[model samples]
Target: MKYQTKIIEKPADTLTPVGVYLRIRDQFPESLLLESSDYNSDKNSFTFIVAGLLENFKIDKGVLSVNHQKKSIENTETVKNALKDFIAQIHVRQPDKTKQFNGLYGYTGFEAVKYFEDIRFESKPQKDAIPELNYGFYRFIVAINHFNDNMIILENIPDGETSQIESFKNLVTAQKVPQFHFKANNDETS
Candidate 1:
């Protein structure tokens, strides 16, 4: 059976990081998905978080078709261990300087309180400031997903608004999806 890959890019204003993460976790089966990254830095750590969520779905049946780099870490035990290590490391590290730290940490529970001092939200902003902040967030998301060739990026088109499910569908239809193929061992395909 052919699988449907729906790349949902939640609106920065509307959906919190936890909400988006949960939605993605609940919707897809573990066996059907793969999070991609090269073990370069903490920047790609969110991929592991997503993979951890998928691992929850793989408790009974095992995950299949992992991109080779993550093949060893595909099982539930490994994913759980990775997540535990990640959290421990984040805690031990005191301040995570990665972009994911800024985005995901800001919206999560305790981190939200700890990092509240750094937040710059304005209840009553000047007209110019509003546009600038929106542009900044948009640019940030674009940059984060730039090197993620395995994941499909659904951009919020027409500039300032959040991306909708219809927008995701339209983007997928427009051939904006990633062109890379999953490789296992030496095998490759388009």
Candidate 2:
């Protein structure tokens, strides 16, 4: 995988973690933001704003999506094995780990208990419910360093596209908050 990395240094208190997240939430689909609540704690450090989705795997539903292409997950394969295969397909060759971070963020919960442990908290997929394991394949992420107050936009440019980098830079460097069109964050203060 190829990488196009951009580093932005910001003045302390100029850019709140939520402020950074809001800028891209509307622009990117399947975006997620995470922040540390306590700045003083070492265990809870740094803010991660994950944007863009290259691929998604909804494990519980037995579905895999690559560039919108869908396929059924194998029943015989263990979840871990399926995950390894999925990662191998999209991220077969690991990128250089020299960067601060490079990998997808995911959680294993609820139904996953059946896979690793004998315990059963599992159930069939229901309408409008969270999946057991939903993993996304992202080429990059915005990593904020809480201690130093630096925001870095990281990207793995598999296709060598620089346009998205420029857009991401704009998203992070906007000087002013956009006026809330629907009356939230507006002067009306309803």
Candidate 3:
């Protein structure tokens, strides 16, 4: 079985375990069941949440796990250690970076761009209307930007490569289409 993972490194103060878990679940809807367990034998208690996603209704599966108590730490050192362990497990899974990035950007409706210094066309398909031209891998620069309250910028996408920038842009733009706005009401009883 092949799976990928990523270690989240945000500070404990800013960590949101439930939010992360929910996001992961939403991304992998095929997951039928999610489980959380707590182990306590020594002085410390450890809580782990795991979710499984089914693929092809067969062997392919996706699993995500997180330490539920790690987000409640006040001591920086303890938090760091807990986060390290959590990250270690994530890396062990080795999640797909590109797919993860696409999922994140897609959800946020942010475009990511990569610039290619040099790009060349290997072969050009015959065009019935337009003349076909071929270049031996020419270099080009690509930039992806998003229009939202928060903007995300990715630069230097190489040629012959497809990315989620277009899809993200389209989703975002569609959501922002002209819509009805509600007015706020004021009360003067006090």
Candidate 4:
């Protein structure tokens, strides 16, 4: 699988992990920022920040949505099968191990632990329930090397993609994120 790599180096004085995250967080939900504050770390030392979704995986109340292509999965085996099929179908470019930092990055909730352990739950749906699992796959990431004080914008476009997509420069140097002010209509010490 072929993928495009974009490396953008800028002076550390001008750009920072927090600054970059602040600039792009509003543009995309689930914008991730991971920092390894330990100085002079090894090959694992990279601050990764990425927004926007190349694909999304979510399972809510037994309904699975892979990039908004939904399926009702009634059992764990079915859900596992759907995920295997959907995940395999989504990515055209596999991670190139030769690259410095490239692979699947995501978080899994503890419910998955129960599932793997064959544990059952006496669970009830709550208001504004979160998904059992929610994850996203990205095509690009802004990786900052703490040791070198340099930033590399890695854009991994699938080999099959030919259409135009947003660039790292545009994303990083774009307009300021909109700000919002919220006020409580009634104030009480409840």
Per model, state how many residue pairs clash: 0, 0, 18, 0
Q: Could you tell which candidate, 1 or 2, scores higher by TM-score?
A: 2
Whole-model Cα lDDT of every candidate shown, in order: 0.28, 0.63, 0.25, 0.66
Candidate 2 regions off by >4 Å? Answer: 1-12, 41-44, 60-76, 91-98, 122-126, 179-190
At residue 46, candidate 3 shows an lDDT of 20
Model 3 per-residue lDDT at 178: 36
User: Which lDDT tens digits does candidate 1 get at residues 102-160?
Assistant: 22111122212212243434344334331110001111121123233232232222233
Better of 1 and 4 by lDDT: 4
Compute the lDDT for candidate 1. Answer: 0.28
TM-score of 4: 0.72
Task: Tell me each candidate's TM-score.
Answer: 0.19, 0.73, 0.23, 0.72
Q: Model 1: clashing residue pairs?
A: none
Q: Pick the candidate with the highest lDDT.
A: 4
Worst 10 residues of 4 by lDDT: 89-98
**lDDT: the better of candidates 2 and 3:** 2
**lDDT string, candidate 4, 11-88, tens digits:** 454677877887878766678888877757766667888766677777766567888988776566766786677667
**lDDT at position 149, candidate 3:** 16
> Which residue runs of candidate 4 sit more than 4 Å off their true CA positions?
1-6, 9-13, 37-40, 90-100, 158-167, 173-179, 182-190
lDDT preference between candidates 3 and 4, better one:
4
Candidate 2 lDDT over residue span 1-190, tens digit each: 3334444444535788788777877777678787766677554367888888766666555454444566664443555675676667653333354144556666666665555455545366678666666777565577777777766667656655653766677777687666665645546543
lDDT of 3 by residue, 58-87 (tens): 100111113212133234354346434543
